[model samples]
Target: MSSRKAEPREYHGAAGGFGSLQGIARIELKERAGPGAAETLYRQNKPEGHMCTSCAWAKPPNPHLAEFCENGAKATLWDLTSERCTPEWISRHTVTELRERSGYELEMRGRLTEPMRYDAGTDRYVRASWDEAFAAIGAELHRLDPKSVTFYASGKAALEPSYLYAVFARAYGHNNLPDSSNMCHETTSVGLKKVVGSPVGTCTLQDLDHCDAIFYLGQNPGTNSPRLLRPLMQAAKRGCKIITFNPLREKGLLEFIDPQDPVAMLTQKPTKMSHMYMQVKPGGDIAALMGVIKRVLEIDDEAKEKGLARTLDDAFLAEHTHGFDALRHTVENTGWDAIEANSGIARADLERAGDVYAGAKNVIGIYGMGLTQHVHGSQAIGMLVNLLLLNGNIGRQGAGCTPIRGHSNVQGQRTVGITEKTKLAPVEKYRELLDLETPEEDGHTTVEFLEALLDGSNKGFIGLGGNLAQAVPDHERVHRAWGEMELTVHIATKLNKTHLMPGKSSWILPCLVRAEEDMQASGRQTVTMEDSFSHIYGSIGKRKPASEQLKSETAIVAGLAKATLAHRETRNPKLAWDEWTGDYARIRDLIAHTFPDEFHDMNGRMNQPGGFYRGNGAHDRIWKTDSGKAEFTDPTVLNACGIGEADGRFHLVTVRSNDQFNTTVYGHSDRLRGLEGTRMMVMINPDDMERHGLADGDLVTLIGDAEDDMERTVRGLKVTPYRLPDGCLAGYFPELNPLVPLWYHDKLSKTPASKGIPVRIVKE
Candidate 1:
């Protein structure tokens, strides 16, 4: 559907409840899957059904009758649609013609029905058998060094399939397993590992029950993880304080509605979630955190002098942590003037928030891209850990750090071994299982993979699932690099932009979505997924496949892998690929063989009440860090205003509309932001607009201003005056992703600094 003009309407209530009901109802009508659609929605995250493909929010033991959210409906309906893209449709349209549609429309057209291969002669995809596609791909793969190949995992992949991909890639002799996490939560992984020895979040969902305070630092759960609103509202109702530190006012964090609660729907009353919402400037979160910690140290000093209980958890700090004395001294010496200037938070507000944090018995810190997508992302995350450790907030019933992961299984995929920088699990374990030596060299990350593609170091890419070209920053450069690849294969269920821009020769291997029944040779199969909180469980699709030609991801990967590996000397028939493909339980057994501590007896453990928890050692007052204790890191953050000397540049933070999740745009309307039907505008503070002599809808061109005068610009954006911090602009991603420089990334995590782009707004 082409975007319509001006239907901007304000949603004057808590997010969710009726709004969610309306969203599901609307999507239900669009899909016309009938009563079964209702069953489909209800069965999601429940036993004998699928987990949500929308986000990685932790699931409760018992799912609500409506066990899904607004965005969840979009994700399910979009994947479970009745529409199909047949080879006939491909023949009718050329590659150039199909490339014109937005990613939303391409996906809305529905599931890909059959295997197809690109025909250079006709510029169209021609029907091909599974064997033909696999053989062609295998032939090309055999000729290249494994180092020239990259396997990118989408967030949608279930843990079983993800594990297979990882094992298969390494067994084939390469570790180039770049994934969606590399783009989103790589900083969290790098930062948390350095601080707590765990790459995942330290807290579990059960922590929310006893939580006293929740801080949102650059995180907006409203759009990213709507299911988190329920717990947030429950905490608020129980007198828990929710403090927010974001550049813009996010609706979900401000207020929430429990869609599952009948009283909430009838009363129409909203639960105000945030006790204090600070409009922290772009890239000011780390500084704001330091400001709060500085005040906390002061509060602790005063409390000790008054002969009262100290704010600092001295006992826990002395026992489980190191470097507290030095960190406390450094924070005490920090000037309030510098903190305010850098953090964009007043000293008084910081003190107020600090007092609340120090008073709370249990505190939980929540964050998302805003915290991780910065130049000093790892340092900021370390500060978050440091903030929690000051009061021993972690390793308790209701305290810890949370990174709101988007996509259903992005974190799960990471846990199961989709990594680039290093081996997730021991290589010796997999070497015996696969009967092959794993690659010793480090692999390519998303950015590094792209760099390799351009330099002719990498030639082939196998995308398990995801829109690599659309999702990455510097879109034009990424697309150009894709053209240089020798081969590009996308195993997907829909037609995305990445599929349109194929390599010299490309193949579209249509595969099964999670909601579709994957009947393998063994019998009906079930795939497992890990949530944001590291809860692992099984999910089985109930609906019939849209097309018989469609194959399960496991089957596709298995078939191609069998064909490709057969030609290599490393191939071993005794590895029993057929058995693993036939019954996914065999795959689980293989995984358990590797990670026995977590997945041992995988099939037996998943049938438990709420599945199994991948334990975090840091949550139990056990330190697995390199130093055997939690080490304090200095929280020194720079501010945009102070860093620039009267430069006309604005600090732009790329954001998603309420209708969008990751790169998937459900619709053009963003009701929460009062936008009716357009993605061609940027959100700016009215004060900033006034300073620039700009009006509400002024057309402007934006340029990325790096320190060395490097040029990166996105043009023709209509300004939408919003309630934002002064000198900060908000724009939608994938579109605004072009404005993010590929070189501007966190040095430690290698995640692009998408949230803190320095931009100069000029009237066009």
Candidate 2:
């Protein structure tokens, strides 16, 4: 095979102008959604249309006429493409043939049009009736112990199906309800619960408007969540001091041009985004945060000694917080020498950041996978909170921690009870209201889910949406796990690798996309979704279904539930599976009843164009903690990748390309990085590249070794020289995801340690 060549071009600013429009058009045209693209985009942002599945960034209280960004447009268009996949066409391509195609190639093939079952005899997917698929799944589920069944969901699914997914698992006597959150922002949930007594970000999306200082730690907003750039640009224009710490100085973080602004587009001049940029090495977030906290404490002491207003909030601390003195002691005891050496940031820089942080009356600290996809991800997240609480940042206007979540409605999934660790409150409430007796024992997480599949413990799997096999690490081992499952079912839209690699008895239950209308017995129905900030709103798809046979995920789940729960429904007569499928508003009422305090008036409130807030206690400074006060936590010196310089190993962090969203590959190009026509590229510092005797465009192999000394290799990744911190290398994921061992994750969250992996590079 010939190596694909790509040319590098520099991006001067963040999203806006012709580039954003052109990028959207490129994929729309590729998917053949060009004719009605404008109308589709209109409904995508309109009140009557579905929510943007691109980013979970909260929508405005009153959204503008134009609400979505370029990425949202791309996401909507991709899902509502004109192309369709038929059983005849699917049968034409064998599993082996499909396996050879790239993930991008598979998605581009078009939407799955009909229910299909794997026929191993012919090595092809043949059409199956909905009844046939459900019966098979129900039979398999009944054969296995409820404890052996795993009910998984994707971040893309709206609230209705996610609710049914959780309810179905519990009613069937299992707690193995794992979703995308386990692989993404679970650390934020775990860490925040310990510190602020809340699992979600304290600040709402509108709160960013009040912040005078914004600290971005190890996140690239441009590529991951482009919609976030709009507020960052507005904040910069208002003269807010924005400081960034990451291995790469992303173009989006450096400058931005609001395509919404006419003058900026005409002038080619961009808004200066980051006033200060610190290129801290990977695995340094914990140390860097401690360094900032130590500096802040030192300033507070000096101010107190001078009889001036102190850096720490005295009244807030005395009344609403605990363990401050111990946290301060830890920060002060962590030597400056260790902080600087570990963080790859100078002490003077930390002091400067502290000055900026103190100068601004309101501040917000934001982070992404770079903080949570590590061995000590939970500890790292708590350290950020410790830094924020020193000045009482939480509950302050325009000031708090924002764990920028990826994927739409991922937070909502957790809010409605799709978790491995089932809480007693929600479980008890469901049993009381729904008249159901569900399991109490907690189930497996994402890593543990696959591990169970590999062992004999787990025998069945049902996915709501997403390419699970591709998203998890240790691809080969995951394949082995799939092969072990007695039955597998996928509620998906696009044809991906996971569908091709099926269990002994597998079914591809093609479902409706968010961009298409989901009509049922009660007529056209609308589902509810909550954003990252907990703004709950209604999403009604306007576009007609791509195929007549396509069913909503809600309907699919309902049919499954109706069939599966037939035997157990005598005692639980209130289980209204049919009503939920008929009118999604009924699901909202059930949800309101299940979570009364947070979800009151669910049916009426969601109808409002702007939606409603679920209300976080942190937003009100009412910490629902064990002590009824916000608590301080001691910082831990976590080794992100567990690599030593003497070993000649590089810290590898898996990343998404500019054109990709989660596992969906729009194209091979990453516009922000100026790389096009390929995704098989690895970036390393010039010094490290030279040390390995490699040059730009040179092909190299990446090797990851386990503690058992078992070697796993990904061959022929082209090297690209970057201005990264020494000992750090970056590559696009789904490709590098295999290098991350299943065991290498945050002890609490179990999120894939995709942000940091230890590997050695060898010339191919």
Candidate 3:
């Protein structure tokens, strides 16, 4: 309990003004990119340079000189650092010693200079040749059954590598391909697909320009996707109402100063971002959404009774949707008391939200991990889709659901067939392009794959990128399981905690990042990525590779595939691995050939300015579902709040600090939350702290409320009072991931319920 303490202060300044510039300057100085900072920042998110690896906010058709945000600069500078994690430097530290370092410290050690192999004899990583590493990995992979080997990818990879990875996995004869999507936006895919017949968001960047109202649910844009703040500010300036529903009044949603706007930056007068901020409690999004829908319906009925203009789009409902009557009945039959109790919002406020929603001609529903990382995440997403469906907001100029993605190419990975589901994989395309028949059996998701690792069903792991050991829930359990694997290979630009959890035969293959030049036999190659808006674009790194020994992800995957399949008997003989690695265009050609509809002219279109759209069927009102129309989920079957009956336990939501992105930590400070020098602090309501006999900086231990009888606990967390709803607590992830049992996830999507985790906070 004595190990935790934090410097907490109140931040009255708006998001993204001088604060962002200061943060950017700090990172640039720390990374020694000060001299080249202007050039690097200006080139980010531009057609001529590499894409920003931070977040997947769509690039505007006409981007500003400083198109990137503070986090984007952090990612770019972090990759552009002069430090190197050479084999000699790594040999000085033991695995146990390296494991004790923080994620930020480990990553800051610098980029991996070459391949490394774990030596159990010395308990340290030793230098290994690329060919030797690949051969050893391939031998182990060949020895194990395809089902026992899982191929995991991080969204940080570009499209060329992602496509090659999926093709190699399918060609290897199993579907155990789980990527970053499974952890972050899988629920968005699962929930939206059921209703609109498309697994991606329907809205584009252009939609923000014309929307009358933008409803933000469980989203903090300032930290998650700062580039989005510009559009939101523009919309607000044009009189568009921005309504936000979240547990905390995130500063980003309250106000913002556009760093790109010269006048706003000079004056320091913040632009009001949100017209209405609904501070809903954890696990209350579904109930709150239902409450709003009920009021909208009630108002529509009143208008009908008065023979006035109908509030609901009756024509769209009749011709374009199904199960409306059932949905209406369920909403009407539900009592106001249940809605008010579950949502923690009064009837009057719900009606007011409904009034704004009903008055808007076009409304866009924007959400993030808050809506997807819960016990009932899919249902929450479905409810949002249904709300937009009510007013015929979808398939319009400025409306539809948009799930802001955290990774730059997470969607692109999925689009190129990185999925565990047999139905979701591009099976026919693989058969056509690679002359291989993919396995039809459904494979493991991120959760299921980890379970496989724990149960001994899976013995091999091949990570294209990411720090899975820390990214998933039940961090300790997952890390222990990883150490028992037969072979574990990580393809990354730098060292991470995952590299320290060495298996029986472990290796690290350093690859070129998106911000570095990736030279191949075809010459300096450009890679592609798909944003949250389904815009596929190219990225050509301007800087030289961190090390000449490093290989591009495409080359690494191709090398491994060639070596592994050499040992196994396969029907496919024309894989052209050498040719594909030599020319990235061949990979893109295969991708275009496989998903013709989405990537038809990929090679030509990917490099074009602003890229080309991977058109969404739902956006065109062309439902591809069995019913051939948008389907409404039966509301009776959905839970209002899946966290369970109210008790003395506090609902803990694990969140990312402003200094971190996903599992990657950049620094110890969170400027937005006004917490510095530590990530071990918890934010709780003032009333809850008083009830628990706790004061600011008091240490506490949170106990999991899982029924599995697992003893999950995290101690030495400093409590800081905040404006969160009573009985709700917020803390950083990975640190608190231990309290989230591996089983605590959405049953349908299998995404970890990082939000709304029921736990007992006991002061130490």
Candidate 4:
């Protein structure tokens, strides 16, 4: 349950052998899931069982005995834990007292058992009936303009719940539905849609199996998604070249011993994962990708001159894409000096990578937040798409683009219409088919919502799930803004900092998680989740609900909708709230009716064992763009790292430890990084540490260079030397969120540029 209280030490062992087993054992022992633990593990990733609550990796048709990763197991165990935070227990502690507890400590307090409301008289939370909470929330919303309220959804919820959440919001007359994707991969959606006519990844797990090479960029698969390591390891074992570009040499990508591989686990032999690893500088993804693409074009030119087999997929490019001349001009104008200076990669090394890419027949590119959390985040994605297009890697069996999604159903939430963009075709279709009254103007994103609250424009907030206060940048600003809201409602499995940072009137409602049984009136309900690859799978929880008072997300959303829409008039005359909540299939039916293209047979597909894939137009080479072809965007003006002043400052990137997933701090241990007992440590290059006159374990303060006249500093952070790029630094997220300004974000998608934040480190 607790991490080891020892000094940080280097972990030289291969990732995911005995280490993974030990982590799983610790979670099992701490959570005390009893017999349910074993059953839950067995059910994880199974077609008929609940989906893994961790990463959004696609499940294979025939899975290994252990398809779930250590983090996945921990998530399930944490959800199935016997401990409960009852109304009485919460009533005993004041909001101030609970706010003082660390995130990990609050998580350890266990699942919330019932609906509760903040009592100003006692400064504590007391039990409240669902009717009372919903009525009070409805009254407040009725008093304010519908555009002033924002509805946020987390990726943890399934498609059914997300769909109902969107419908509920539309019925309440606003399109302010922002989810987890707004902060993480909004750029992925924006960029890919512009370039490839598809927002989701075009490839599946089968693509990884057949791809000749994979260019993995800006992602730490080991800690971010351990299940992903399996495919990477398998690819490496089969002699497929796995080229990686990341500032930190992640343990999973470097070398990995599969916990499920009996031979490797028994022999303690690790498989070398990344055939070629390039330590790219923070916020340098655009330059790095451009350099590789430039080299690929050069190699193609040489081949043309030599009269050998053409290096580029000329036929595919000519027929399927446009803007090649513009792309070539941009890359040619970018000098090697600037490329090397920005990317922290030498020309020779980049050429070597380009050689591998040019030689490979099929190269699949995978990326994560590293590419999407920058000022030019969307353009960075465009660069990667350009790399894949150069070789005709897309619309094929073994090649395409893959965005490693963080949450289990973040993509799914967006798929089912949880977004602030009212212009999206599917979103508009949902509004049209449902005959709902929604605001015509585009609504606020996560950052815009926070800004509105700060500026006194927004008065109400309804969060389906997520620790918004801690999950976003500018933690202090978010906390302060949240305190000024007139009404805030959160439906979650447990208590978090967001709940403690209550508004004038706040309510916390307990809900069933992925691993719990939800016995609706129609029978035991099953929810569907769409993975990163667009595979939809049915998930029916194996364990019973944590408490009898807990309700399913669909039920809660329906209850709130019924109370809030009682006096409101929408386009839809008849609203059957009880029937929809009683059977989730009705919600799926509406989803199919709204977005028939993707979810035509969604309800029927749930009956299939392995589920079905939502067809992607880009995968089939069906360009739905204005030109009827894929766009090769110009990357000339998208090269800046968004730093205020790079001189004498470190490009600080926020990262998640192995023990945590997003804002949920499972513990203080970052076993993969050899860190324990603390999350308040910065990983810096040894050369940078020497330059700053600091040693390991020295307490330092990081001052943000927002240049906005607002002072931002994270003090007393331990300096831990790492093998990062010279001017780059890595620190755990949320703790370092304060260093990022609210105004700094990707212009196209409004995703907070969490990475490459310029800061000065001062030793205390």
Q: Tell me each candidate's TM-score.
A: 0.97, 0.97, 0.98, 0.97
Any residue pairs clashing in model 2, and if so which?
none
Clashing pairs in 4: none
Instruction: Give per-residue CA lDDT, model 4, range 573-691, as digits (tens).
Output: 54678998899898888888887888897889974655688789999999877788989989854353676446778888899988988998888888888888899899987667777
Model 2 spans > 4 angstroms off: 1-10, 568-571, 642-644
| Predicted candidate 1 versus true structure: per-residue lDDT over 1-764, tens digit per residue | 11232222345766786776776667667766544777788888877778888988876887677778888877888788777888898779999898998898888887899999999888888899998999999888888788999999988888888888887788777889989888989998889888888888988988988999998888777777888888888999899998899888888888787877788789987889999999998878777888889888888889999999999988888888887777777777878887887778898999899988988999999999888888888888888898999988888899988888887899888877888756565687766776666788889899898788767899999999888889887777778778678899999988989999988889999998888898988889999988878888789997898898999998888888888888876557656778889899988888888788888889887755466897878788777788899878865554422235246877788888877778777778776666767888888876677777777677999887766555677788997878877778888888988777777788687898888887889888
Which tens-of-lDDT digit does each residue in 67-122 have in candidate 3? 89988988888888888889999999999899999888999888899999999998
Q: What are the per-residue Cα lDDT tens digits for candidate 2 across 1-764?
A: 22332233356545566688788878877887856667767766457777898888876656666688878888888987878778988899888788898888888878889899989898889999988888888777777788988888888788888888888888888989888888888888887887888898888887889999998987888888877888998999898999898888788898878777788888978788998899887778888888888888888889899998888998889998999988877887888888888888998998899888877888998999888888888888888888888788999789998889887889898898888886723878787888877776889888899888777788888998988899998887778668668888999998998887888898999988787878887788888788878788788887878888889988898888877877653656777888888888888888898888989999888867667888999888999888999988776563454544546788887888889889998987788877777778888876776666777788999988545455678988888877778888899888888788888888777888887788888888
Error of 1 at 301 (Å): 0.7
Which ranges in model 3 have alpha carbons more than 4 Å from their true place? 1-9, 569-571, 637-641
Candidate 1 versus the native: TM-score? 0.97
Name the candidate, 2 or 4, with the larger lDDT value. Answer: 4
TM-score of 4: 0.97
- Model 4: residue 9 alpha-carbon error in angstroms: 5.4
lDDT of 3: 0.86
Span of ten consecutive residues with least summed lDDT in model 2: 1-10
